[model samples]
Target: MELKKRIKLAYNVLANKSVITKDDQIRSMLDFLGIDQAETKGAVSEATYYACMKVLSESVGKLPLHLQQYTEKGGVRKAREHPLYNVCNSRPNKYMNATNLWGSCEYNRNHYGDGYILIDGAGINTKLWLLPSKNVEVWYDDRKILGDIPDIYYLYSYGGGILKLGSEEVIHVKGFDSLDGITGMSVKERLKNTVNSGIKSQNLINRMYDSGFTAKAVLQYTGDLSDENARKFTKGIEDYATGKLKNDGIKNIIPIPIGATLQPLNIKLTDNQFVELRQYSALQIASAFGIKPYQIGDYTKSSYSSAEAQQLSFYVETLLYIIKQYEEELTYKLLSEKEVAEGYHFKFNISVILRADFATQVKTLSTAVNSFLLTPNEARSKLDLGSVEGGDRLLGNGASIPVGLTGIQYMQNKNPKKGELHNAKK
Candidate 1:
């Protein structure tokens, strides 16, 4: 009942925002909701505070009826009879931790082993009912220790407990040291190795193309090429075929002779050969300038023989050289201008206000002051305050005043007429 009351109070406090104040109030509320005191309290070590928080957290969620049920059902014995009993009894192993025991058979069985049991006893008329399938059967000293008996006899007669069957229980026991020898390799490492090998093969093909091998050279290296590299090269060739190289000004290059020309050359350059020629030329130019080819426009063909087929190898190589030069020139320009510009600057002004009743009065006063200071020009103009200036003050009466002074000034014309004195005080 106390726990229920505390839970209700916590819910009410969370719903109604007006009752809470200070960090301690929040801590007390959390304590009443059964949150761990150590987790909520940080490093504060006052005995009374610790005791109060502990009692509150411990008492929270604990019902008298729950205790009575536990007592009537024999507490721990009833818990052992629960469906989760076999899962809890299984010892923790290297692959399976204590937390794994809490999950269903689907997740836990994958690593730990199949830990479920199914025993059918009910006939068709009664509908199927199952007793737990026993894995390991324990025999008493007096009973003949020969063959297996029904699990029911072990449960009812002998005090010896029976463990439900699992893969681990069925298989012969292997020690912890066995896992050490089973090399643990990751998917990422395998993928990386495959990619690196592809890159190397592509580099070799590029070298071959630069050495003046024709499109057929790519087919020769196709056996050595990885699936990933082949796919990439094929994609590059497709892009080349569709005139995408127009951006690099190689779309118009025609290597093959027209119909009028006699004995036209058959240039069957493969994807790898084209990549090789472009990369080789780019590298030569980049080497001359003491830079990496990727820093420039590295020519990438859509297909294996795209460079040779489209006759864009020379132009693409030249473009990469120009790109490298342009990048270097732009970088130099940026560095030269960096010293001329100034860094960022900012200004701040702080105002402090003090009041005895902080919660009720100070908050209101601070808000009003801030609102007045931040009011729009059109709104401030209605009060006849000409333009807002830093440190300028406005009196309750329609008067513009300077800051740091508290007085009203009046100017009088000095002249005595008839029976009136100009300097008379009201």
Candidate 2:
């Protein structure tokens, strides 16, 4: 009830200018819609959802994904231009691109505690469509867990129906859910109070600037002609004070009658107070959504080094969780039975986030070449350059040679050394 009142307050404050009705009428309109005013106050009003969505969406969606197969030497290499890779890269479906799909998944997961992708085919599940958590209900009976494919999902939106997919269809991607429910726990559900508080603070700021600024004053009209005239005079005073009767400073001075007195009211809210309150509330919202303050372009509590570290921490701590969830789900459900047995699986280019500055890249690549971990051509490939002649040969001065006798070692092994000959002759 208290939250509903706060939502009503926020709604009234935002909608104050749209209608001339009293506050009760506005509350009735909101209530008639069966909408909990605070329901949208979480993501729609608070900065938490926007900041989290921007970071998670662009980072997860824009960065490339790869389809990789194990190589002869047992090292996994990306199968570039693979059909599945092209599908995920260029288009996930007819309606949305890869960025939009992944961003929607991450956003829905954050808001609803679960994200789902519906695959239409049986093997090599490539055909994908995203579903809203609220619309798709997970249908799992006792035996549904042991089956290869997930249980049939009942989709409620767009003229509802049950989706009877074949085996290994309808991929389920969920975040951390301690109760082991079908969907993971939603961030909004847990942080309702914290989020609402931030929103209420914002609404408070809006209220302060919006209709809340009306100053109440005392006026003494000693020689009023009639009750009707006094009411008219009071209305004029309100219109003038609130700037409703604007005359572009032409009527700056008003000559009062014989004994009329009006003095302005003393308001308590100051400019600095709102600034400080808004900043403090922002930090609270940022923390609730696992976003750093600076990520949302709030740098008041951040420095260069700390902000950089916070970015890395966000990738490792926050983004990694969601990425891994996708990777595992796709690998398990998307791959064919033979492909899985043959070691074909899924992996995201997580190291893409580790791209360094120019100087750092040069230093790192040089070190990798010197250590023989990357051949010169491999290093060139990283820099988007073509391979040069003789760049394929691994060059290093380390004693850990490849397991084969060189010409020098074989010749020395065939004949006695000169030093041994000299000792024998002596």
Candidate 3:
């Protein structure tokens, strides 16, 4: 297609055409990161962007990704030799480690409402790279897609020089976009107003500091005064406020003229209004980004238990959904049609976040072993200990049950000592 026809098709195909909105910051962000950079605007504040991205990236990066094959009982995990495993756990690309790959996917998803993980190579040997949604244009016939038998997919990826666009046949691991098409709703876009309010609040505070912390004050005179005299009086007051006193070059104390009285007009406005506005604005921004309010130091009406619950909620409600989306995307995009039919899939092991202390782990493993759910060797292996000679045998309540109906018989046969009696079955 020629540039003119392609441009027309692009507009016809894309839900949001190329055109930056009026807001400068939002327009720049969209042009930089939107699906169609030529014409779009995504609302996001400079104040809360880093905080939102940091929280999301760290939350996702710490999870362990695994490739598993289904079994009759459940699914058995595969690592080391698995081709998908190596790509996800060992190496993703030349520049990024496993954490970087996972975290960057999540970071872009949160910021752009969609993240594209491009998969390269074939079978087990694969490489993954993130494609900014702003630079990616998905081209497919709408009628073909509705029929559920689309023969071709044209994904245009723009990178390299200013006007260069790259085309590829293989599809990338597509992050879940809240919206249906290229134009998706992001957290940053959702909190545009709140973040803008925060920006305005910050500006107000900065203006306060920049004007020697006395920008809200006014000059008034009881008797008639000329405009020139009024200007002079104001200058005198400003000089006194920011003047040298006690040989110090600070603006704290000032000597007033004999009959002049300086009354602060916005004393009430400066006291708690802006502070509360900013505090509320910060909470809204954090909430919009799915971050715990306490994480950003909003302790209003917060208690120890509440904070703990919020932390767990962040993992369970927010991060778990994101992690599951990534797992499904990786499974569908990474595995072949034959592999998917064979029940191969990807999963994230989030147990690291819930990892208990050494004592707790040992106690839990011991209980599992005593209940005959796991052998001693299995528990030891979990603890990274080498196997011992009889560790594989399952031990009942009272030593090994070679030929016993009850644990008491074995206990009586052994005649356990007082300390050993603690292992007796109830």
Taking the tens digit of each residue's C-alpha lDDT, what string does model 2 give over 1-426? 356776676676567533322334445556656566664534556765567667776788866777788876888877664557766666777899887888888778877777877775543346688876666555664466635654544443433334454335666777675476566777667766766766776676576566436657887878637988988888887666666545566234444556888876766656447567767766776676677777887877575474346668878767787788888788787776787777677777765676767677778888888888888998888877999999998877676544443334444455768885444445
How does candidate 1 fare on TM-score?
0.13
Which of candidates 1 and 2 reaches a greater TM-score? Answer: 2
- RMSD in Å for model 3: 9.1
TM-score of each: 0.13, 0.74, 0.69
Q: List the residue pairs that clash in candidate 2.
A: none
Which candidate order results from sorting by TM-score in descending order? Answer: 2, 3, 1
What TM-score does candidate 2 get on C-alpha atoms?
0.74
In terms of lDDT, which candidate is stronger, 1 or 3? 3
TM-score computed on alpha carbons, candidate 3? 0.69
The residue pairs in collision within model 3 are: 18-39, 19-39, 19-40, 34-134
Global lDDT scores for all candidate models: 0.33, 0.68, 0.65
Model 3 C-alpha lDDT per residue in residues 213-311, reported as the tens digit of each score: 664466555787898988888877777664434255555776676666787755555576767777777777777776777677666767646434565
Q: Can you tell me which runs of candidate 1 are displaced by over 4 Å?
A: 1-69, 72-96, 108-114, 117-146, 151-426
